[model samples]
Structure formats: C-alpha cells, structure tokens
Target: MLCSDLVAHYGLKKSRRVSIQESLGIFLLYLAYGCGNRLVQEFFNHYGEIIHRHFHKVLDVVVNLSKDIIKPNANFNETIPEHILNNPRYYPYFKDCIGAIDRTHVKAYVPQRYQIKYIGRKNYVTQNIMVACDFNMCFTFAWAGWEGSAHDTKIFNEARRRREVKCPLPADGKFYLVDAEYPNKKGYLAPYRGSNIRYHIPDFRRGQTRAVREPKGFKK
Candidate 1:
C-alpha cells in the first residue's frame, strides 16, 4: 500500500518562506518548462529573487551529492575486469576496451534574452551533456553546459581539451567504446562506418536469417 500523505516527513527542512515540496516543485518546474525565474515566479506566486534563491538552494544540494554519486570506481585503475576476461567473445577482442562515451540532451532553463542560443535540432531548449562510464555502469566523468545546438563531436573535442573538466583520456593502449556519431580515433573506438556494416542490434536479433553476401560488421 502506498502512503497517500502529502505532508509526510521529509529529510529536508522547509525554508521559512517555502515548504520542501514547494521548493522542489519550483526547481523542477523551472527545468521542465525551460523558463526564466521571472516566469516561474508567476506560477509559484513568489518574487523572482525568492524563486531564484530557492532554485539554487536546491541545486546546491544536488551538486554536493554528485561529488560522490558521479565519480569513477575506487579501483578504477585495476586490471581488466574478470567478467570481461572470462567471456570468450569479449576477452581478447575487447581486452583494451575500457569504457563507453556518449552524449545526451537535457532540458535547460535560461533567461529569455539568451534563449535563442539554446535551441537545438530537437526544436527545443536543451543542454548537450557529454558523459563516460565504465562497464559496471558507473559514471566516470561528465562535461555539460554546452548549448543544445552544439554537435556531439564539438562537445567531445571541447571536453577533452578543457583541463578543468578533467575528462579522462584512455591510457596508452586502452580505448573507450563510442557510438558511430563520434569520431573513431586512437582512444575512442567508434563502430566501423559504411552502409555495409551491420552494427545496429536489430540487425542481429535472434531468428533473423543472415544472407551469405550481406555486409558484416562487429558481429560478423
């Protein structure tokens, strides 16, 4: 049975001017609508300054939690994981593969004056977030705040070059798996391109008959 209580005990203390749920709602609405503080103020019935302060207050809590939640594994530098070593299909071929890198778009809120730059190919405001993770699905590094219009390749290049981002680079012989959209380079391994290559998982699903002359890719 689910508890239907709305004012139930919450971990966060309510501010003098707002309850915990209200504060969270203010932040979430700002994110969901991608609207300015002034616009959010109208919906929440609070002054823009109060809304801005609470919005950032909630954001600070999230930022502090990310310090631990978004870090790499403690033994990240250890030898190749045993699961990979024991898997016959992945062992030798993927011995040097370390992790995976990708990008995602997150809805973003900006002042109306600067919203023009945030519009993306998706036809909405967003932030392009570049991230990398190990096989265990643990995030190792993330570089965000790029305009939604930015291409994945452009964000990747900037993330790698920015010292403050500390975007981890592969060691001498190791590489990170990346999608086809990313460039295939020394440390980033993107699938072999060309229409002949059948890399999409649907192409290899069970019961799908393979034609003898069909182009083969990583799953050949």
Candidate 2:
C-alpha cells in the first residue's frame, strides 16, 4: 500500500525498489501510534529492528505523499472563529473582522549568528511568530521564525504586501481591527489616538462617559 501510493505520487527511483508491504507497514505503524522514531523502534522490536534513520525515511515518504492526498482545489477553505462571527459587540469597530493578529516567540537550539540583532529588549533570545487567528481562536495562518528584533507592525505590513488574507469587503467601505502598534490606514481601523479618547480607555463604556454621556434618563 505504501510503496504503490508513494511510487504513483513521487515516482520511485529506477534503481532502488522497496516492497509495498514493507513501506505500508512502517507508515501504518507511525500513523497508528503517532510516536517518535525511538518509541516506534522499541514497540516493534519483537517484529524487527528499526533504527531512527530508517524511521525518518518512512516519515519522508509520508510527507511526500501529502501532496497527492490534499489535491489542488479552486477555493481555499478558511476557518474563522465563532465569536468573531457571532458577537459583533466585542469588535464593534471592525464589524467584519474575522481574525486577530499577534506575534509570539519560540526558543531555538542553534540560533543564527549575528543573533544579537534578533534578541529583544527583554534580553531573552527567540524567534518571532506572527499569527492570524479566526474569531473561534483557531489559527488560520502562521508566520514564524522571524528575528525577534523585528517589529510586529512591520511584519503585518509585509503580510499585507504579500496579500496573504484576501477577504472580500463591503461595497461602502472596509476596515481592519488592530492594536496601537499598527498605524491606521484606509482599510485599517486602530484605537483612538491619545489618552483623551475615552472610548478605548480602561473602565470606559461605549457611547457613555463624562464627555459623551446622554442627559439624565434620556432615551436614544
């Protein structure tokens, strides 16, 4: 099963040949347990001896076969969150906003040289990962492994430059919701400017504050 499908997908080298049963067994074992190479080796010790190197080869075959499994489609399916779609109140400023953008970091074993440039002001070294999560809090896209020193705004701009998320907008106008880090643009709606803008301030309610409050018992 493994050999036949892999050969059909990637076309095996003319010289090297592996039996279908052998490759299929290894792949099935990996899929069944989802264990690392060492664990797989120990588990199947009674059947036969399997090393990390051989296990990695089987993994490569599976990776290569993925292209065939996930064949090309005309329309890409984007998974957005429920809150973004259901609760427009939380995101009143961006009614159509379906995702949130943020950057995170991860540790690396062998960081690239000139690593000082990648270290943030906090002093800990790591990679910056930019993610756009749907309203459901599911990750729709992940942009990671960037130098930590890079700015999230710059990364967001780059993502826009690449035209990654191309959602359709309304006929009248379109806008995005972002934090203070990103600059406001025609299609981008950031929080109000300065401390005087009470709507975005802590403990401030929308359409209700010292400046914008209605008269006593006044009904809108």
TM-scores of the candidates are 0.67, 0.49
lDDT of 2 by residue, 1-220 (tens): 5566667776542223334455555557776876666665565452334444445566666655553443212222332235644666665544545445566777643445768867875476777766654455555556665777888778777766765333222133534456556656665666655434455445374554433433345554
| Highest lDDT model number | 1
TM-score of 1: 0.67
Candidate 1 lDDT, tens digit per residue, 52-105?
888887776655445446766655555686667889989988888878998888
Q: Write down the RMSD of candidate 2 (Cα, Å).
A: 10.2
Q: Candidate 1 — what's its lDDT?
A: 0.75
Q: Pick the candidate with the highest TM-score.
A: 1
34 Cα displacement, candidate 1 (Å): 11
